[model samples]
Target chain A: MEGLSIKQRFQETLKSVYFPFVAIVVSLLFGSVVILATSSTSPLTAYGHMLKGAFGSIAAFDSTLIKAIPLIFTALSFSLARRSGIINLGAEGQFMMGALAATAVGVATPNLPAIIHLPATLLAGFLGGALFGLITGVLKVKFGASELIITIMLNYIAKELISYFVNGPLMDSASSSYPQSAPMEPSARLYKFIPGLNVHTGLLIALAFIFLYYFFLWKTTAGFDMRVVGFNPSAGAYAGMSIGRSTILALFLAGGLAGLGGCIEIIAVQGRLMMTSFAVPYGFTGIAVALLGNLNPLGVLFSGILFGGLSAGALRMEVMTRDVSSSVAVVIQALIILFIAGRQMFAFKRRYRYRPSSEKRKGKTVVDDATEDESPTVQATAGEGE
Target chain B: MNEVVSFFSTTIRLAAPTLLAALGIVFSERAGIVNIGTEGMMLVGALAGVIGSYVTGSAWLGMLIAVFVTVLFSAIFAYFTVVVKADQTVIGTGMNLLASGLTITVNRALFGASTSPPEIDSFGIVAIPGLSSIPIIGPIFFNHHIIVYLTFILVPIAQFVMFRTNIGLKVRSVGENPKACDTVGIRVGLTRFLSILYSGVLAGMAGSFISMGMVSFFTEGMIAGGGFIALAAVVFGNYTPRGVMLSSLVFGASNSLMYRLQALATNIPSQFLLMIPYVITIISLCIVSRKSNKPLGSGKPYIKE
Candidate 1:
């Protein structure tokens, strides 16, 4: 709760940036070494294709952003729940439910204009996902069931339910075909921002949600309650916060974001619910996005893009390289999660910053600075500190 | 009547792998560390055992190798979760993902991309000579593969070890109150590490049973969600070997019922019939939550003061 001046705040931010930044570089370095050992080809050439697939061409970059859009929402959903100290592993299920709901809405409302139809579909998706997550949250709070297991089990249940619906009630009657819903009306889809590009305004909406997430988490009373409950429910209760309410709210809010992701995925990219195969597993990948982004909304925005880039590139690499499949990116993602989970990055920071020589001096400086606040003293090197 | 008996007997055989895996999970989780990676561990073991048996042309050797390699990785897994203080949940999830990726990658490289490996008609039935006269009881229970028989024997042995042995008491105590046990001179972390290693052996055995005993070969994600089902059984059994065995039997029965119901196809679609197992699981889980008997500090690892 201690508020610092602009310069000191900048210094604190700089201190915190090292862990995530270094983690990325180190993980990529390891990926490079792995590439060299396995491929027996220059790792650079393969990485060049990775770069080309993500950013070398306008088409590639746009597709990357398109893939990134839903992830930003799911990651933001994860971050919101995480800040309050609950795990929302159900986001993938929620996201899928959202897609199912939106597809139903999109197909059912073909006569409506784009403006009316699009938002309605999204709202349905959001509500579906949010409600799905809320069921687990409510169960955990009311009945002491574990949300982690419930969500995992619910994922299979949800998938089967959707398959049943699509193959039966919602099956497109035009053709005897796969278990996929009818395509959305062109009017129901997101309008592409650039003339011929696949990238649409969904990215803009996702970014907007990211900003809202940041504001809600960092600058609101309810956000404070969520964070307090996250820190410790007993303490939060002592502080007059309802832990149950916060947990429920956090899950639904997170689920709402994921629902939006699902809506965007269907309406913008696939224009239909893409049948899940082992080939592309984007749902689980959101956890990596949330971790790589360090569970920050804006950070998730970029990390989502990074993963999307990997997703874009790795698919190509599978064909272009032949020996290695796109699933190799999975190893990299796992390594990132593995390294980050050890708390080693944070502990390493504590070790360096609390070095014996630095600690005594820094401790003295902290006391001195606290006392100096009484005098309103001005100091030089503020720019360097910032 | 014969159809019903055969159906149930087949269910027992089908559930043998899961029953064994659930028992494995019971050992590990009772020691207080969650082993959600049981699925991945099973996959790796299944692959390694199949490959080993294929190359060596001896199913027993392959099964042994699977157990060793899986136990080795479990040690690595133990080191990270136990020694490094890595979060078990994340590590477990990573294990599943890693097994899936590596299995396919290695399978392709070795066999040039065949999904099914060569069948080893290696594992044989353990037909007890005197027990055969017992009719349905003997056929349903005693007459089975060597591993299945071993599994049946081991469940009782596991129950005895967990309830009767001093080491078992210490393991359970470490899970419940590691601090108190540590104060009294028990090595909490080491106990957990050993328990996890024990789990690895049983889980490996289960996987090898599938590859060499259940099916003739291995396929990607063949373990599929069975490992997770074992996980549910562990929790549902309240961490007792007997309880775990019973739950695994129930799961096995439900799965068998689904297949039978699918075959009947009187009115319901096969898809709907296919959904029966998961639907039953969800309903059972909901009921279980309303009345869970989870041990205190079930997921918390002991941190010695």
Candidate 2:
């Protein structure tokens, strides 16, 4: 690795993460232009606020890290599934279900040791998400159904199901009126690594999984099978790999990761489940994180942190300068994604524009473009990218 | 029975949006490009329609503007996906978020509130002279608004388009196999772009119906996940115009039924009723997905060398 030239290393990084890197830069530039046109707040000040809010003080850093913890878990889950060719957009719903499952255990279970209680709660979360993911995965393999439709339908179903649970089965009788569950036992809470920071041991747990995922992908036979299946299932089948099993496992693992994120949120971040809240957005954002990270386990950490910073800063932006809507962050993120999608379009146009007419003599194959044929304004009807 | 008829009548009115949106998805998807961003497209169109109507005080002018603006936006999508060849899933998802955020941001900036759009006069109901006197179908079918009639008119037009013309054949050929179509001189990208633009126009109409017809208002997230449901209807309809209309009607009536059921007290939780459409979507998809039936090379990028 050390013998490799700098240019080679740079090229490799570009090959792996170039799409997201370009997307981020393009989005930022677009964001700066928008800010310039509208708000009195300069890009530098907005960025400064973001940096300060994310890492200015120990408390801020802790808060940022804590927020990123669940994202890390879910993003990693998405990466795992992506590697196996399953687009699991249901992580948000899975995350919520996981939280609901974990909370139920914590609230219902009797006395137990802190160690056992914490792990059990987390296990419940993982199992719930894994089960949810596997149901879709299994149905896909067994029934040849498009996972896309199933996952989307399941997402809504799960959302409503959980709403019902919280509203009826899980509602806290003692609390006033709103639909929400009781806080878990103190024993169920994750232990803190950083004293007084409220930074739970979940960070280390997330990091640990990252390392495990890295090793699993690069060093294990099962990982190879999953990757192979992802690249070409027919080839994997011809090579004696069980494509069905790999798909199921990949999705299950992804769901487990997302489930763990939900568990972390309950035990380490938010204490209990709340009905009609924002949980799925993070799941959707995890796709961005995975893209930003180029699907590398280690890269996800940085990307998650970056997105976490944006979220943290958005809150600050909202509080300090109510004049500038915090939704600017979403716009920025959307721009990054837009640019990435449009990157090849621009490149193709450049080629057509710059290349001499005589140079286009060969019968070159055109890449078939597939994208949503709607404007961003029409996007509200679609919701979170079904 | 009167209550059912009244509800059914109201439902056809409500279903106007879904039917239009489903038709839009059909055009885009039948051209072999999967359009998952119909939700975003509708929102943009709705906002465009509202803003246009508000500024000009003309519903006709508003519809025209909606089609034009939404088509332009769809053209951007077409430019990126058709010409540039980006990952459709990622691009489509990003487009959805971008559109949603941008519109809401613009709305808040313009309106000073993140609530409903300013109201406008709805399209007046049209009574088909003697048909209004028919027994069971009378009030539900004959006595309806222009938009409702328009939806019905589009179905046969859509069917004719999908099955009759050279363009439709080209579209079908491209969707099934771009390579095969390209070999025979069909320009897949251009067809897809046109189809998508067509989708944009109808989707705008669907959005406008919500703002200008159903409620005469726009709220944040007003498309309300109908875009995806429409996409689901595409597969359920098996890419045929007639099949799609039937699927749309089922979904529309289901949505209407849920609202009606909501009016009456039932033992089951209201959340369960809300979940019915989504649950049915999953069940139906599971069934559809069961046969491994889909357009060949569906949603896959077509690259020519």
Candidate 3:
């Protein structure tokens, strides 16, 4: 890339950029068809309302930023694991566990000073999700169980566990009818940073972690080892790196990130953990964000905001056009992932490229290029052979 | 005594969907494609079944439509994973999300976001005269929705085809080594595509059984994690038809027992009871996955050199 001239570099960037742009455009087009088929309102009108709701006002932009916070966290979680060759599908469950832990600490240890209590609650949330994630990692390492199936199973188990807590021990006694936890105390809550805006310090944490994610993955030795394992476990193992350790560490950190997102969401946005708190599915949406961003940290930040806008706008679209469901946003999100995953479908031409001298080196570079250029899903599946 | 009969009967009835879906998983997995999208296919199938029945006024027609739509859905999945050579698991995950969103959208559009499910024609028990009358054994097995019997009958047929037939041999060989299969003049891509489609057919049927056979209305998220459980059954069954059948029955019994225990007002919390199948799936996966009979080339997309 550094060897390329300015024009060639611009062309290369265009090549990388065009696919996701096309995917987003195609997905929105598909979304419009659904709107047209289902609602009496014109698709254009619905989209206009959606766009207005997402960015037309300070309040709308605030909501978009707020929604993007959790997504950024989950996307980081996914990107971390993908970098380590583990598919952390349990982020949803981990996020729920994080919220549960935050609630447990937030409600139980009330009246403490903000400094101690707030950080304590946040730490609890991280540990909650981290331990949950470690369960999958341990099972995979020790038992050879596929993380894919285990993570999914853990998600269902985590939901049940949440229900058990909310209905049984953690049920808010003041409101016996509602299966929800007691609200967190002032000290444990994530107070809004801007005076009138609804956004919280969680946005700062999300931004900080985005930088950390880039730094850790690209700069640190451990991160380099994990990426090597992800690229080719056999080669990494041959190079004396422990695959088991990388898998466990990656999943643990991934879970913690998601958990922290859940924690912040509870303390800042929701105020209390309710049975229906997971209705939006932040974890799955994160996968779309991560993929659309091409698994780059900065890219995830932008895509996260974009998805946040989509959801924020979708709510208004549903209201303005009562016939249309907000779930159309989900359809668009899913389509983006599908298109990104099956990107070869969008390729119309084979561009001539420069080749390295050694055939063996060329093969390795191709795999690396595939990892960077295409969705991480391709590399994850290819690495499964190890 | 009657309670015992009812319990076993409920077990079989509950097992039918998982059994059907697991049968599908067996076919797809045997052909070297990991179908994590079985859940999505089943979801679409359930909704399509209801829509078809609502329109045609026949449960059988609903079942046919369910199969048709699900096949079309899986065909897209096949096209991506087979022709486009995308990652199967990732695409499957996308398929699940798409299924969830699309079902909710379509269901809301046609039925108007009402909380109450739309009433539609559904399958009913067809008691086989002589067999259904066999006192103790008859009620447990003989009397069920037609799909239930069809589901059980397909077990042996699937077993026969998977183990005995030429097509099954080709499918297994292709999964084991696609390049070798290609070398032997087998059309690897076509075989895999068909195997995935066959899985789609059975998964659709399984889903139809859920909406049209077990109940008379469509509910959002009705298939729940039934598709994933079926995926587990495929693994626990060691990728064989008979194994998958037994695994499905085990999972079905657990589900049936959970509901029964909850109804009986047992001391155990309903949440804990509800978690039994998922927990059991994880445990069973751990126990069975040790031998690891997973297809050598299952998750990897085949690229002919």
Candidate 4:
């Protein structure tokens, strides 16, 4: 790969894209079967409704972007942590903590100027999520706790914390028994940037972060060190890189990104943090998005929008097709992840047929070419070769 | 004395589902597969149990159906992780999402988004005739749901089977070193696959215990981190059957105490009370992680070269 021409590298990347494309198509096909079995409406009709709902109008596109903004943020969070070799399953908790902190800051000081109030609220949200994510990193490094289990535990704990706050200390008194916080001050709100569209400045923020994600990972020395550690922890340690620092810093940034998403979601879209705000599962959906995008920043942007379309469209599909539940979106999302992760299921028999002949050649250049031809399959099988 | 007796009785009852699932975890983890999908499998089992009883009107048949469905569900997980050599944790997360979505979709499709949960035949308490008469021991140990007794009885059997049986040795060997097992003609993939399916069966039974044995109906997200708690118990128990039982009992005790505090109308918020088990799991994991005896091949895809 290092010796490959620029065009060859670009072609290789493009070839990898087809795997995710195939996964999406396969998942949607499975989803159609579910729709056919569960509802009276034909799968075609249901899908038609979904398409119309997602892209038939200016309003629908706006809804798609609005739904996608948070997903992109969370996808970035997952992608960053993953690139650094840590599976941060606590994005859900981090997102929640972010929203919680944003709410606290957004509502507490109502009279401040927008510049200070809004940034402070956003910063608070980021800090909240970062701190939450740091717990997993700290526990893993210090106590040898499995981040997989600990992150899951933190998710439950965070949910309870939200329930406790919304039901008691932070409950909006003027709302008369509702378990939700008061609306953010006008200064703290994120106003719409696009003319006549419901989408907020969050879209701009998402785009900026996407670029930053690309730049930081590809161009920065710190990001390179983190990636090296993620690729081979022992080797990185031998090379004098601090695995702990990379892990801790990666999680902190990852949490902060997701937290920023939560903050933006509250200020731009929901207006107030409610118990029901998390019902959509932005964090988990972001995982699907991240995987679909192959963990590329540009790929994340597109997949995020694609998932957002699914969500926005499913609501309309449910309304039009009374028997089809909107949860089909979730099924499709999960299926995509399954298909992407187990992509070997889709690998062609050509690989098997080609391998023996390649081995017969046994020339250095020929073997390298053979490996290059089967690079995707080899990478898929050996990506986690630790 | 009555409070103490009832408390002990309640602890066993509360511990039954998690205990059942943890026993299953012991088997799967011993064979080198981390059954993170246990939570998802349990959720699917709970729904299947209700559906089965709703259709058949027999609680026993419902339990059987639950196990059958979960075995099939876990088979998909096994195929992906074991056969395709995908990352076990990634596939597990997918299974969880799939289960959650599938359950809700199927439930609403069948029940029409109804507010009232569907009613079905639930397991009944069975007391041994003479054993019921004993003052403290009978009620606490003998008189309760049949699942409770079966769960407690399985602990010793699991301990014996795991430690003494040849099959158990093969499973432990596969988990610790799959490559060596493969060289010795042990069929590592098949052992891990079967171990996961066995875990699925117990997880399904545990799910049935929650929806049918403990209550008469299934609710969305009813497993409510019970699977995770069971996983925590597996770690806290040091990967041994007896240890898992003790860890599950401790969790159950904390859960029972939370309920009691809620019943007594303590100043502590009910939400915080509900958080006790999860909090305890985290704290316990921290303490137990230092001396971890986790399977060497756990969470790794065993690719045959």
Candidate 5:
């Protein structure tokens, strides 16, 4: 490890940053083509409006930040589970459960001070999402049910649960026409920092979590064990790490983080829960967010903000240009995921000038490992390389 | 007796899309790609079918266009998973999002917001001359859209092709062990690409049936979760065409039952009625998890050195 120089370390980090940047640019370029084909307005004009809409003014920046808060938490949820080698697709459901639990607690508590009530609601949100995640984790461990299918089923169930509550039992009596909950009392609501700006203290919580994510995952022993299990369960087992326990724990944390995101969206932003909520695919978007961030804590922060900016800008572009649908943001996001996932296709050449031949040899071995399963060819290749 | 006939007819009608999509998935899974993007591919097909029909004033043209466009989309999936060695599940999810976004964006652009697009001519029930007179089976199966008949016929065809052909052997071999297939001189990438394209074509046809055969107009997200249910059918069917067809019938029957229950106007909440199919899928999946046998390399991407 000590044999690496400063230049090599810089190149490695730059390589990590390069693909995501290229992916974003390529996606946006492809997006321009879509806009050109569909709408009368030029892609440049629409994109110009999007940029202006996202960050041209203080209010725009504020909206972008506000929109990014839930994404950050959801991305954190996804990245945490990915680190443990579990693809937690239930973030959408867990986030909804968190919002539901927070709304329930917030509506019930009318006398507590801000400090007490806020923490209680947050805890409720975490527990709700955690329990939801635990169901999938436990199912996978005990019954071997694929989390992918289970989580998708759970998301549908969660959506139905929310719809049932808002329409039947938890409906606001004062607003009979609308299927939504009663607004939270002032004591429970998150305070806005700037006057007249929609930005709230939830940003602070998200930032704190970003740091905690870095510290907990990189600095803690448990986090290391989870990552090891994720990388290779058999190897982790050989190293005395419990794969099942790590799986469950990582998912729990993931769900709790996403739930906290849901809680914040309700308490700090929306104030009440609607039956038809999450007009956007925030949970799915978070997958892209985690991947674009390369599953790094700080990287998630930037990618979350970038996506939030896109979301905010796309809405404005739609409003300003009547023909442009905000759903184009979805296309751009999908394109980003495609490009990032297939970054190997865009690799021009290896940058390790000092070790290009050896690196190419290593790359060949990796490809062999990927396409083959215990074949003699793999062994033959490995022997020749050695 | 009339209600039973109506129920069976509706069940077959509803099951057609899932059956078609699952049939396509069987090919891809057998060749080593899971192709979860069927939902997205179906969505694109549905919308494209409507657009094609509206433009050409021919529903058949719409179905053709749906297949063509969806094949293009599947090619993208093929490029990413088969050639680029990306994760299949993630790419599938991305495809879904892309389809959802692109369809809405294009729909809004083509036909402005809020106003309903003009309805185009679509496939209707086609009764067979002699078969329509069969006592029990006539109305239930003999009298339906041409797509429905095509779907049923495709099942047996799929079974035959998958079980008794050289290509099928190559595809299954690639999935079971790509390394061995490669050693034996099979073009693994090309086989996977063709298999994925089969899924793409069928999913598009499934989408076209929804927009043109079942409903006359395309709405945003008209495909809904039909693709996902098809995916479940693929799983429940144990990766066999006939098995997938049977599982699709079960889901189709549940859908038909839901419509019937709604017509009865019972006091029960609609949400619970909607929940029925999903609940059944979850339960079935849990039970099947104990004895499941997915393709060995179903979700893995192949990367040759």
Candidate 6:
């Protein structure tokens, strides 16, 4: 730090920000080609419409924030689990379970006051999601089963369970037999901060959570331990930390956070527990948010909003363009992932040299170079392994 | 007796797609790449198969296009995981998203929004000469499409190749210990890349079977987690071709039973019945032989010096 000049430090910061920016631009440029090939709409006009729709009016901006709120929560979930070196692909299921529990409580009590009902419903959501996440954690910890497959299976089960619940057990009796639960009691409803706007206090809750995530992960002992376990289980075990406990704990917290996101969506946005209420692929989109944010809590907030804007605008793009569905947003999200994963292309010359040495360390160096952008602890673990 | 015959036939039919995809996973995972993108590749293949059949009016042409498109997707996966040394799981997830978005967008462009594509020609049951006449066994085994027959034939062939061939040994060795394989002059990246491609082809076939053999048209999410179920089958099968086949059969049987019970309007909620295959797969996964001979470097990318 002392040796580097101010110019070098500035350059480093610029590099960190510039790569992702370039990747996004490149992806959009490629996306335009897709738009041209698939549809007759000019990419420039379509993008103009997208920008206009995302921020055209206060209402549009409010909707964008509304969409971002859940993304922030889910992104935090993915970010937290990744910190512990676990992948929680079942955020979709966890989010659904959270919604289910919150709905169960939200719809069951129509007479309670807002002060009590809201907190209870939110708690139910967190607990539901946590419990659901814990199943995968427990399975991985106890039976050594791969959480990847287990979580994927759980997603299928959760979707079916919710479909059944809305269609049968929790079906509204008087609403023309739609596959949805009865509307929530007014007490359980979330209120908008701005009267006419779609934005709700859920944004504040999401922001608070972002702060909490940062605090828990960066400033707490448990977070330190979890990060240690994530970077290297062998080192953590050697240092007397329980890897299983950390895995369970990390996943549980992740699920709980995501579950809270689900609750907010139900109480604030949807107001009803329809089968399709949480069907915006928030959980999967969260993965994109977390990765784009470099798994940093603060980064997640910004990335979440960015993704929200993309999604919010995508609908308008679909309406204005020919054959350009909102699904193009998904393609963009995936493109971002591909770009991030393959960002090695941007760093190739700087990081690698055409050294003719046939040393074993050469291969190890390449491996180290690939994982370099990850957390410092992963770098440490790589050194130890070698 | 007739009901029993139908149930068994349904089981065979249901198992075929999963069985084929699981076989693909066996090759890829054994070669040190856990191809969770099987789902994405299958999605691509399913849509491509529909497009091919729609344009060419031949199911076989659809199958060919499915394989070709899936291979293209797999190549992207190979470049990232094999050449760039990125995280396999994340890239695979990205591939799934890419496949999902691309398929839907293309579907909207080619076919109108919210409307299903026109039904195309699909493979009907090919009753083999003498074997198909042998009562219940014949009905279950012999009365299937050409793809179904191909899927069955693939089992022993895959088993023989994986166990008896030199390429199989190289693939397995690379997964178990790539460093050692590299030291021995074996091309680890090339092996892993080819294995992924092989899985792509198999998963493509599975996708085609779903569209052309199981149904005559493509709809949104027609693959419906069949790819993941195939992954479960691979794990449950202990990564053996025969084991994958048997586990796929079990899943298929449960899936068939669920459909049957739903048709019968059983006292049990149809939703819970619908969950039988997934729940059973999770349970079976837990109980499966823990002595899974998985490659040590199964999910790790090889980095060449």
How well does chain A score by TM in each candidate? 0.85, 0.84, 0.91, 0.90, 0.90, 0.90
Chain B superposition TM-score per model? 0.94, 0.94, 0.98, 0.98, 0.98, 0.97
Q: In model 2, which runs have C-alpha deviations exceeding 4 angstroms?
A: A1-7, A14-18, A33-44, A55-57, A341-386, B113-117, B124-129, B290-293
Top-scoring candidate (lDDT) = 3
Task: Please provide, for model 6 over B12-120, each residue's C-alpha lDDT reduced to its tens digit, 9 standing for 90 to 100.
Answer: 8899999999998999889888888899999999989988988899999888989998999889998777876667888888899888888888888888777756878
State the C-alpha lDDT per candidate: 0.73, 0.74, 0.86, 0.86, 0.84, 0.83
Each model's TM-score? 0.88, 0.90, 0.95, 0.94, 0.93, 0.94
What is the per-residue lDDT of model 4 for residues B4-29, given as tens digits with 9 covering 90 to 100? 88888889899999999999999999
lDDT for each residue of candidate 1 in A1-386, tens digit (9 for 90 to 100): 16899898786566446546666666667666656655544667777777888888999898889878877888887778777767666777788888888888988877798888888998988898898888878877786666666676667666776777678767777756777778888878887887889788998898888889888977999998897676455667889998789989988888888888888888888877646521344556777687777777767887899888987887777677776656567666656665555434234332332212211111100011111111212121111110
lDDT of 2 by residue, B1-305 (tens): 88889788877776678888888878778677778778778888888787788788887678778778788877767766666555666667777777777776667766756455576655667889999889879998889878889887999998898789887788777777887788888877778778888898988888877777776766777886777788888788777778878877877787888888888877879999998788777766766754433566567555654
What residue runs in model 3 are displaced by over 4 Å at the alpha carbon?
A1-5, A352-370, A374-386
* Per-residue C-alpha lDDT of model 5 across residues B1-305, encoded as one tens digit per residue: 98899999999999999999999998898897877788899999999999999999999999999999999998999888887767777788889889998999888888876897777979988999999889879999899999999999999889989889998899888887886888889988889999999899999999999999998988987876788888888878888899999999998999899899988999988888887777777666666766665766667655454
User: Better model by DockQ, 1 or 2?
Assistant: 2
Give per-candidate clash totals.
0, 21, 0, 0, 0, 0
DockQ of 1: 0.24
lDDT of 3 by residue, A202-280 (tens): 9998999999999998899999998888777777888999989998999999999999999999999999999899999
Q: What local lDDT score does residue A333 receive in model 4, on the 0 to 100 scale?
A: 95
- Model 2 chain B: weakest 10-residue lDDT segment is B289-298
Q: What is the lDDT of candidate 2?
A: 0.74
Interface RMSD of each: 11.3, 8.2, 5.9, 7.3, 6.2, 5.9
Lowest summed lDDT window (length 10), candidate 2 chain A: A362-371
Tell me the tens digit of each residue's lDDT in model 2 across A1-386: 46779997796565446556667877888777766555777877876777788788887777788778888888898888888777777788788778888989887775888889988998999998899889888887887666766776677777887888888888888896778887778888886876587788999998999998899877999998887777556667889999889989988988888888887888777777786455337787787787677678778999888888778777787677665666777778777666755554323232222212211212111112111221111112111111
Residue B301 error for model 4, in Å? 1.1
Clashing pairs in 4: none
| Candidate 5, superposed: residue stretches over 4 Å from native | A1-4, A350-386
Interface RMSD of 1: 11.3
Off by over 4 Å in 1: A1-11, A25-44, A277-279, A349-386, B112-126, B130-133, B289-295
Against the true structure, candidate 2 reaches a TM-score of 0.90
TM-score of 1: 0.88
